[model samples]
Target: MKKVKHLFLLFALLFSSLLAPVGALTDNSTGASSATSTSQSSVAAIKKRGKIVIGTAADYPPYEFSVKENGVSKRVGIDIDLGKQLAKDLGVKAEFKVMNFDSLLVALETHKVDVVIAAMSPTPERAKSVDFSQVYYGDNQDIVINKADQAKYKTLKDFDGRVIGAQNGSEQYDLAKQQMKGAKLKRLDRVNNLIIALQSHKVDGVVMDSTRAKAFVANNDQLKAINPHFKTSGQQGTAVAVAKDSPGLVAATNQTIAKFKKNNTFDRVYIPRAGKYMSQRARQNTVWNYFVLGVGNTLLITIFAVFFGFLLGLLFALLRWSKNLLFHSIAVAYIEFIRGTPMMVQVMFVYFGIGELIQDIPAVVAGIIAISINSGAYVAEIIRSGVQAVNHGQTEAARSLGMSKQETMRYIIMPQALRNIWPALGNEFITLLKDSSIVSVIGVAELMYQTQLIQSATYKGALPLFIAMVIYFILTFTLTRLLNYGKRKLNRS
Candidate 1:
């Protein structure tokens, strides 16, 4: 119990040190300098910085979507054009940060992006969290259905008792709930996924922006779009969202939007430009080109996570083995907490929650940190079980030889414990490799994210998914063989 208490104390100290920098950086990032700058208005900051970071979910087309330019993926659409124009009006450049649709408002509130221009509606609920510019682009909501079933779902009333799909956190989703009452709603993060669901008959129809619906219908022969004409309180138009209290920035964006409106930029310029990019599809040979990039990032994240996770696991294992009660409790608590929660939530919390404080932390870095922390908890328990499997006599024998606890652990116990836990640790590494896909939600450009990009770019869902599956299989299969080889060598030695 005394040893356990000591271990807990040590773990606490180490954990505190690990977190100290985060707290320090948070303070520094929002310190007096930041306070003083607050007086200068958001517009002044953008002018001084020379760029406005625009957050957007780029999977929705015509409004915003991904297209490859010279073998590199680029976000292009009406919204992108408007963002560029807005930045130009502000005398700065536009820099876009792509993420999930649901995360856009949070990104704005956390100051991760200066503005959100992702075909977003200035709904009353959203206005409470972030300020919105005047309505910039307006369109009727439409329901997209399989061409075969187009006549089956003509109006809103027809969708009642049927399954309807919409992107989560979208105005369409809300409309389905309020107007198409009795319908089973399937909420997905990406519009591409919703379209896939519609095509597969998983959902009877998908509610989406009229322009986006038309774009999808034009690309896919099996799909057709129809207007359900949802009853809305007022004009439901897209707007630029900014952090609350940034009246100067909102006004500036409103001015740019007014110019856009007066000149009919949406119809004359933005739509045609987006359509031109959309018409250009990748050559057949280059369809799987993004897999290489995905593999590189996947390997990078898995390798670094395994290295750091192992160290943390070892530390926590020692803490769990300590006789001190506090140490045992701390280790136990951490292991259970991590094991109980899902990795997806952990990845998001680290990216959005912790990243909120360390505003400059990259999404990839946040993903690695979250994965490492989660892996550490499980690894710690595995190590503890391995150490317990060793005979108690080994410890007594070492102590009788006048060896200190530290030396005994380092030279004697850890070696056997490692051998016993090697397979389990290898399994953990494999699990992490597959689990790394969760970081795609934060736009880490990993395997899954790249696959989504390919899906949006090519408008072919199943093929891109199949390619990603095969690549993942190849990676895991090779890793399994290497792990087996190492195990055999360990047994021989």
Candidate 2:
């Protein structure tokens, strides 16, 4: 009976090994076939996914910005409305992905978004990177100036040698370079930022899309747009951008854009819906209120990241100390790789790169994970050094007293190693807190992100930046004092 059981177990192991590759190959074959099928038609791929993702920078009003309806803030604008229409035409739901305007093209190229429907001009430079649909709207270029200087400017040559501004990567930038000869150009990332620059006299004027300029000037009494605009090199017609691989998607989008234009949807439906949000008047949230919310989120992310990072560091330290070559190599590789790269790149990779595989990872969660993983690598080195600092005699003494290696590690070595490393750990915590600011790029809504939003909304660039700096000082100063107090308490006990 025993011999028969042994033979049966051997057969079972052999059978399982033989089936594993066949199962894996079948899955690979299915995945390859589906990929090929999807590649044939981008329209079919979007419909199969059940939603078409549209990327837009939501800070530009009347083109793409936030509005409150039914007490819920919804993204509304001409471009947003057209995005919904395009998705409907393709028979899929529209899902809007809000991101930095400068990152929109990268988002599309990386498959983070399916198409870009922001008020983006189909410039020749942009066309080289991605395919553009037929024109949906034609907005002219206008120079925005301080209302006080409105009459001081007549034509592009009148502003020669004066300071000018434009949104970075915008046609306005190109226009400013060509028309505003010998002038200093300040290129900002958002239209609102350009308005702030103009209002504060940081820039004498800004060349921007006429529609966007109108929205800003109407909202602020201090600014006005040039009546006779600068002569730009070409038309400023807005269009949709898709990844170059998606020819079918681009064709479908062009068809929808043509239909919308032919039916006068821009006049009948798009204009009416979008115009309501243009001149909204409401009580604005104070800068302090925004700062308070930002501080709370910053602290929450720091605490979660530091705690998990410490735990991971402990695990990594054990792996580094292990006798096995594979474990030590893995620990060393992770530490080197993470420490060698910038946190911003890591944050983007985890959010967009890993997110490409694992669908729907929240930005906040991804940010925290990136921070934790990064801090863990540094902490691991700190711990490994702390352990080595302990005398070898200590381990020998504990083992000679009938303590097993596990017990010796837990009670004898770990306690001493931690005491030696406590100050280093605290310092790591402080560093992690400061480094958390980098996650703002991925829209974590932390202190820096909130401050930028406040600057854009209130048009008080200098004040918001100074206030953010002071707030950060207060946070780091308080944390440093608390850590010192903890260290003193540890010394007493």
Candidate 3:
């Protein structure tokens, strides 16, 4: 269903703010190492360890949602049950780690989690990362349109120019983008949020897994999927996965699936869980529009935020180091305030507060402005610290050589400061990548926007969201590595 999306510009901006990177290294290394010590060690390791840790983004539904009915402790849904059963089959207790939806794969790759049973699919691209058991569920993307607009929206071609949404870094997202060549694709990270966007009129339509669409639309009388025969594109077959080298977990998982299928338990679980949302066709793929417009919005916002943030940081740095006590005080106040207060609130103030001074301005403009201001305050403190780290005698020496104050600052103080600032600035760039997920509020359809779209589409809790997280980690991890590399380069220079 269609939503204006621009109104949510503020909401998206606020929502996309973020989690710090996987913060610490737990001592699972020995366990992970033992699992990898030999090809035959997986089952043995789990037996000796007495537990298998599963990682999932817990907010997903049906498949992996959290429930606390009847005043009991929280328990996961189908996925958790399935994991527990499989662990029992393997003679171990199943432990799950609830985390960001987008961070799962790297966690798996790094051996932070034992097996990824969070409704994982067998995408050709994803196969490179790990091995999978038999098809747990056949997944299909469903195309949804405003119930109000369904009459005029005869077919997929009619969707051209309409704003569509999906979760970023998701197979559905890529599929939506590829299929809807002419329409505008709004990509986000949280699948549930995308449904919210649809309800809010942020998108004209959205394409997602049939299961999630049923859950969300059944709740919202305003939306409806196109006819049962609606064309679909992305056909991602889902299954449970183990780390690439874990043949034991792989074999154990396959054996479980074999037992499940032989006894009809697979159908009993998969059908009621995911099949209830099946579209018209007996078996078909998910096809939806993509984000043809927002890619530019994403790049532009990042570039502008960096440019403007850098300039403002320089100004604040000058203020921070000013000889005048008043300016210095103002600078300190600015630094402490921005640092102390949350960036999301600051974004709200800029985009929703004084933003009224310029109504109907581009959403991207508001986004860049918000991030630039937020980043400037942070970079200011970084630059101030950098400049202070330089030797005081550098300035004195230049002045003693008869250079003017401005020239001395330019030739002597600034270079060292620049060097010092690079690392912090580099870190900001990576932060900027994660933070840009915030810009979605201004309707800048980026990665997180796409993720939300997928979440809304996939009724399965946490799995879709977790899938989005894995994609985000892939994105941010590369970003961190690049930033770290640059920091190294700057330090060397």
> Ranking by TM-score, best first?
1, 2, 3
Cα lDDT of model 1 by residue, 391-481, tens digit: 9899999999999999988888888888899999899999999999999988888999999888767657788899899999999999999
lDDT, residue 44, candidate 1:
90
Task: Point out the higher-scoring one by lDDT: 1 or 2.
Answer: 1
Off by over 4 Å in 3: 1-41, 70-75, 217-221, 227-236, 266-493
Minimal lDDT window, size 10, model 2: 10-19
My TM-score estimates for the predictions, one after another, are 0.90, 0.80, 0.50
The sequence of per-residue lDDT tens digits that candidate 3 reaches over residues 1-493 is: 1122443354334322221122222333346544552332277877888888776654444566543224332435557767888889988888885544555665565555677776666776777776777776565667777798888676667878888887666666776677778889998655656666776778887776665566546656778876333344334556786777777778888888778778787557754653333221112222122222334455566777887788878888898778999889877776776678776666545544433333333445666767877888888888888878999888888888999989988878877888878877878976876787776543355666544433434333455456556655776687678777876776787
- Model 2, CA-based lDDT: 0.77
Given candidate 2, what's the lDDT at residue 270? 80
| lDDT of each residue in 111-226, candidate 2, tens digit only | 67889988898888888778888888888888889999977897887776788888787777887887676788888777777777777788888887787777777777888888
Candidate with the greatest lDDT versus the true structure: 1
lDDT of 2 at 87: 89
Ranking the candidates on lDDT from highest down gives: 1, 2, 3
